[model samples]
Target: MAAIPKTHRRVVLVRRPPGEPAETDFRVEEVPVPEPRHGEVLVKVLYLSLDPYQRGRMRDAASYAPAVGLNEVMTGGTVGEVVASHNPRFKAGDIVEDRLGWQEYAIGGGPNLRIVDATVAPISTANGVLGMPGMTAYFGLLDVGQPKPGETIIVSAASGAVGQVVGQIGKIMGCRVVGIAGGAKKCGFVTGELGFDACLDYKAETDLDAALRTACPHGIDVYFDNVGGEISDAVLRNINTFGRVALCGSISQYNAATPPMGPRLMGTFVGKRVTARGFIVTDFAERYAPARRQMGEWIRSGRLKYREDVVEGIDKAPRAFIGMLRGENFGKMLVKLA
Candidate 1:
């Protein structure tokens, strides 16, 4: 057998984000893969997810979860094939989802892993559509957005993993789905591929209010906001009475050099009687099976579509990660390790 690399091929937190992350923020190193102890399994990672939420992790500031430790591997969800196991519950060929952070291999303890089926969808979907981001879109939009018949549902970052699913699901639920994305390509994908009723290119919209007013002529019933700041402000201005807003993420503020601003129309809630709630996906982990069943069925029926911008090598993980934050990725950003 070939000898394993002595160092881990992983990305470390070289420095915390000043605004957004830069190349220097991550350092690559090789470290020995640890051996599995009792009740533990050693996995060789195959796919690593790069999500916008990771932007928040780069900051030392506290949020729903702790920041990635300084000088440590950046944290993320991953799919890996078990290579060695001291755990009786898992075999060497079993694939599992792990919070393995960023590394080529990981040794994790019991009760922290879930066996995965590579045939269910794709192994990557465990980190994309059926993963944490997928669950976030599901609970946040349906549970909080509460879209209704004949109502308008708007989502920003509309062509991303979560946003794309959100828009398509909104359409299936009988709402007029409108999407806001950064460019024409993404704008096209949201409306054309994902089946949103309308898409507004944030880059091309000269008068966002005018554009929003035109698309949401019936008034907004639900707004699933992933990109906060100005786009959020525009959506807030059009809220119908009893509308709902699901505060999913704020990609706009993730890499800011300074503090960012939220929708200036904070008072709209009072006028419209709109309800806005913030959530972390883990809150609904118990419901993941139900949500995945629905999502999978939709995919099989062609009602839901998914995409991934997969980078082939582990070394390029950092660059692909930064690009996702910049809206360079058209779908879920994934690092293929195998």
Candidate 2:
């Protein structure tokens, strides 16, 4: 159980930026610690998830997820330990799920939380590999990408949280996995540690077309798109007939002030008869147990590995979150609460 405080620190979105969010746009403010009334519990946040999708919500525009209002706390998933509870289902010391935003404390009511064995994995895993991003890679690849054994799969942002898991899972399933990440370091990690068959450094690729052609010599059967600008367009040009594409996060367009330019590879989709679909993790929340179970089994068997670039202190979450947008983070970006 955590020592309940009278006040707690929270990161507020003080201003909605015209384009990308600056550090000053977010304000670190202290608020009164809320008391849990009946059927409620107070959660002391242990870790906060920082993802590229959060960038879309920072803008005041219509999006899949609602925008964060000015002066409101930035929205995000959190793993927290319950300190006080008036609910029968939850009690002190129980670690639970929460969308508590960038805050140190939260009063949760109703049934949004999913109780977990905090010891099963590190508490932070629930916010990354064992959490939403993990499930996203699983469902997106298995259900959408339909990576068959012996098929050639190409995944972008290969060194990031979702991409690494997808590549590892693809490898385990007998598929040949190729990855695209920024810089030489990330490319090395993706090919060496993550066990991808081949990796291309997007930053170093002088000719994206040549790289795509060389990497996907067998013709790409599945494209796990993470950045949906020129990189995705280049991948689309080489897709095999009846290939599939999983439209995951589009970090390339996330920070753009205006609509991003594209290679306009829509014609290739028609010629290749490719199937591309966009999905949100919430769509498969019902199947979370199965995914989590599979992940646990993989982890125990050592077939799957997860890497997180954790930043210490809740006060630093804003900086970490911004860094993720700029592709400065490697693997899962998370902040340990102060």
Candidate 3:
């Protein structure tokens, strides 16, 4: 009913970062709002999900996904409202989720975009708990980590988006869940609020290995790794024989100028019969429907709890993203564009 704006605001990658991404690496500019053609829809982004993985996309180097080219809109996941549509399936005001990047408007759709029910949960959750992060925890832990009841499961970045879900799921599956987080505040939330058996503050402790040993006396049967640097090295040292590790992220190394050097894990893997596998959420795309149903039930029943740190405005996305990289966000980091 309202007239659509001719131009919209967006953040573009102006320069590739040599290391940790600076706000200057990105530039906010006003661009023409694209029109949708046949089989397409025009979306007005409401929430932009800021994640650690976006850092990898800033590099020109090859990765699982293509890099964000210089002067191009920065790549990101977003929850948006359909403002216009040429596609029969979508209509104006319909909420949807897609990789629409750091922009106010997008003009595309297909398998990459899906309509989401705002009534089921907060539409913003399509970017966090009920979306990629939730699915990542579900499959990464259940399919990859496979914790048996009474076993010990330790998750790095335990109070984070994927980490929080992984720890909660481990507990639900009857495992002794121990979380490794950065500070006392996050550590407290992980244990007291999220119901993890124990949470170690890696930032406060001088000897992470000792704290891990004390917390996981039975040895870690499953390690859901998010922060993959020295923390991963410490976790590997405490794994039980035939332990399983689900590698969801490597946030600590995402901004590194060079490959991070750490203790050789091959020997430990061989001696402990550890099974570690890296995975992306898309690998289990076909099963997202069932996973979402289950996660929704968990949320409704209060068995699973989640937190989101939302920054207002699209202009703040760069700063919020950088903060997430520094472990400054207690949970999922998101930018509210609307």
Each prediction's TM-score against the native? 0.96, 0.97, 0.98
Question: For model 3, where is the 10-residue window of minimal lDDT?
Answer: 104-113
Candidate ranking under lDDT, highest first, comes to: 3, 2, 1
Q: What is the C-alpha lDDT of each candidate?
A: 0.86, 0.88, 0.92
Candidate 3 ranges beyond 4 A from true positions: none
lDDT of 2 by residue, 1-338 (tens): 44677899999888887777789999999889988899989889888899888888888888887999989888999999889989999888888877888999997865668787765677788888889889989999999999999999999999998999999999999999999999999999998888999999988888988987887789899999999888888888888999999999788887777867777777877888889999998889889998999998888788888889999987898888878888999899989885
lDDT of 3 at 196: 96
Model 2, 115: alpha-carbon shift in Å?
A: 1.3
**How are the candidates ranked when ordered by TM-score, highest leading?**
3, 2, 1
Clash count, one per candidate: 7, 0, 0
Q: Mind sharing the TM-score for model 3?
A: 0.98
Provide the clash count, candidate 3: 0
TM-score of 1: 0.96
Give stretches of model 1 more than 4 Å off: 1-7
Higher lDDT: candidate 1 or 3?
Answer: 3
How far out, in Å, is residue 76 in model 1?
0.6
Candidate whose TM-score is highest: 3
lDDT of 1 by residue, 1-338 (tens): 23545556878898986876778889988877787888999888889999888888887776888998889999999998888889888988888997898899898755659888676688899998888878888888888888787789999999898998898888889889999998899998888888899999999999998999999888888999998888888888888899899999888877778756555675767877888898888888788888988988887788888889999888888899888888899898999998
